[model samples]
Target: MSFREKMLWVAFIAMIGGFGFYFLTLLTPIGQNASPDYYLGLLFFIIGLTIGSMLVATLILFIRNRSEVTFKEDERDRNIHKAATQIAYYPLLLGVWGSGALFHNGVSTSIMLNILLAVLVGAESIRLGYQIFLYRQA
Candidate 1:
């Protein structure tokens, strides 16, 4: 696989694993409580875990393929990224608008925050997935 594709795969897995654990934790009985400290800690942990894993994975990949790393982002890669980002934009817009509506309806801050986070994760997942698919096809 190309370096870019490999990086995308790593990002996709990291995001799903990190956020999947986060959301699952939130669904548990204990998570129903709006304890600001606990939520903040968990959020920070997940963010750290996601970013740390991505950085480490990227470093390893770069080490393993130093040559490929230097020549990253060809025309085809750029095109695929552009297409994926454009496609993912729709879900992001929808999610933001929906979150605004929820806010107007006086939803809890925690719920709105989760919704926004979910939207961001979903958009990123879509972008990475589409790029991977395009990479494989090409």
Candidate 2:
């Protein structure tokens, strides 16, 4: 696989892991009544995981294919990305509007935050998968 493809996979995994961790923490027995300190710790944990995962993924890619690290996307990659972005954009827009409506309808801030995060992660995963598909085609 190309370095870019590897990067996308890494990002996809990291994002999924992050989402899982966030939800798990939120669902913990103690997490239900988690203190401010608990939330702060969870926040830091997530940040650490995100940074660490990206670093590890990049390091692996560089070690495996140093030359490919510098490679830029060609026309096909660009076209695929453009198409993926187009596909991802509409739902994202609608999500934002829906979230706003929920807030207007008295939804809790926490719920709204979760909704936004879910939308973002879902859209990104779709885009990444679409990009991978295009890369494979090329």
For all candidates, the clash counts are 0, 0
lDDT of 1 by residue, 1-138 (tens): 988889999999999999999988888989877586788899999999999999999999989999888885678888999999999999999999999999999998988999999999999999999999999999
By summed lDDT, the worst window of 10 consecutive residues in model 1 runs over 31-40
The TM-score that candidate 2 achieves is 0.85
Q: Model 2: per-residue lDDT, tens digit, 1-138? A: 878888988887887788778867778898778765676678678869887989988898899999998878888778989998988888888888988999999987766776787788788878887887777887
Model 1 scores a C-alpha lDDT of 0.92
Task: Please state every model's RMSD to the true fold in angstroms.
Answer: 1.0, 2.0
- Global CA lDDT computed for model 2: 0.82
What's the true lDDT of residue 53 in model 2?
82
lDDT of 1 at 95: 94
Against the reference, the lDDT scores of all candidates come to: 0.92, 0.82
